[model samples]
Target: MNIKLLAVGKTDNESLQKLIDEYIKRLGFYINFNLEILPDIKNAKNLSEAQQKEKEGELILKKIQSADVLILLDEKGKQYTSEEFSGYLQKKMNSGAKQLVFVIGGPYGFSDEVYKKSSGKISLSKMTFSHQMVRLFFVEQLYRGFTILRNEPYHHR
Candidate 1:
């Protein structure tokens, strides 16, 4: 199955972008992967928190196909161990999904519409993280998951 990561805004920090790129490249060896960055909302300063999430949600929904499995990276979502996450990845692959779309929403998080459309939600940690930083962390974890699946030496356990 193809894995796509859709996130709002660009990773402006050169160092973070470089690391995110490296993990994306590593992920390509195991499966089809793509990182699509949705441009940040314009005039966001004037919009309310709800308005911003709504606009960002629209852009996110536009990219999703009906058949794609949408997973949101939400703080209140389910948390799993590394091994368990690998199992989750295996199950998605086994289910024969055409594409697994994971989204990292904008500053105010997702809208009600976006929440309704999601197949499930995953929490990387209980602590909050910057949207840009989450991109890197998620990709690195994805790479680690694949390595665990393949019994590669990349993951210690």
Candidate 2:
């Protein structure tokens, strides 16, 4: 199955982008992966939080294919251990899914409409993280998860 990571805005920090790219490349060794960036909504000083989310939601929806399994990276979603997350990845492939779409919402979070369209949600941690930082963390963890699944030296029990 193909894995697509959808996030709003761009990663401006070069160091963080490097780390994200490294993990993304490592992840490619195990599975098909794509990192998609939705341009940040312009002139956000006027738009309310709800309206911003709504606009971002529209942009997010536009990238999705009909058969994609949408998974939101929500703060309130269930958390899993590295090993468990590997299983989650394995199950998706076993189920013959075409694409697994993982989304990181905008600063204010996702719209109700986006929530309605998702199949599930996952929280990386209980603590909050910047959207930019989360990209690094999520990509690294995804690489770590795949390594764990393949018995690679990157992860330890």
Candidate 3:
């Protein structure tokens, strides 16, 4: 199955973007992976937190198709070990999902609409992370998950 990561705004840090790109490249060996960055909302300074989430949510929902499995990267979501995550991915692939879309919401987090649209949620950790950093972390974990599934040395190293 094809896997897609949808995140709001651009990753401005050169270091972070480089690392995120590296993991994306490695992930290509395992699955059709795409990282799509949605443009940031204009005039966001004038909007309330809820308004910003609503606007971001609209952009997020627009990218999703009815058949896509939507998973939100959220703090309050289910947490899993690396091996368990690999199993989770295996189940999705076996289930014959066309695409698994995971989202990293904007600074203020997701809107009610976005939450409602999600099929599930996953938490990398209980600790908070910058949205940009989360991009790197999530991709790296994805790469690691594949390596673990294949019994590659990358997981132990």
Candidate 4:
């Protein structure tokens, strides 16, 4: 199965981008992983929080296909340990998921429509992190998850 990460805006910090790139390359060895960055909305200062989320939602939805399993990186979603997350990844592949799409929403969060469209949600941590930072964390965790599944030396109990 293909794994796609959909996030709004680019990572402006060079160091963070470098780390994110490293994980992306590592992930390629185990699975077909794609990172799609949707451009941030222009004139966002003029829009209300709800409107901004709505506009971002439209862009997010456009990238999703009918068969894709849409999962959001939401703050309130269920949390899992590294081993459990590896099991979750294995389950998706076993279930014949074509594409597993995990989205990191904009600064204001996701729209109601986006929430309704999501098949499930996952929380990386209880405390919030910047959207850009979340991309790196999520990608690295994904790589670690795959390593755990394959019995690689990358992860340890």
lDDT of 3 at 57: 99
| Candidate 4 clashing pairs, residues 3+ apart or interchain | none
What lDDT score goes with residue 30 in model 3? 98
- Backbone clash pairs for candidate 1 read none
Which tens-of-lDDT digit does each residue in 117-139 have in candidate 3?
99999999999999999999999
Question: Candidate 3: which stretches are off by over 4 Å?
Answer: none
Candidate 1 stretches with Cα past 4 Å from truth are none
Q: Please give the CA lDDT of all the candidate structures.
A: 0.96, 0.93, 0.97, 0.96
In model 1, what lDDT does residue 63 have?
99
Candidate 4 C-alpha lDDT tens digits along 11-92 = 9999999999999999999999999999999999999999999999999999999999999999998899999999999999
Better of 3 and 4 by lDDT: 3
* For every candidate, C-alpha RMSD to the true structure in Å: 0.8, 1.0, 0.6, 0.9
Error of 4 at 27 (Å): 0.4
Candidate 2, 13-126: lDDT as tens digits: 999999899998888899899999999999987999999999999999999888999999999888999899999988988998899999999999899988999999999999
Off by over 4 Å in 2: none
Total backbone collisions for each predicted model? 0, 0, 0, 0
TM-score of each: 0.98, 0.97, 0.98, 0.98
Q: State the lDDT at 42 in candidate 2.
A: 95
Per-residue CA lDDT of model 1 for 50-147, tens digit only, reads: 99999999999999999999999999899999889999999999999999999999988999999999999999999999999999999999999999
lDDT of 2: 0.93
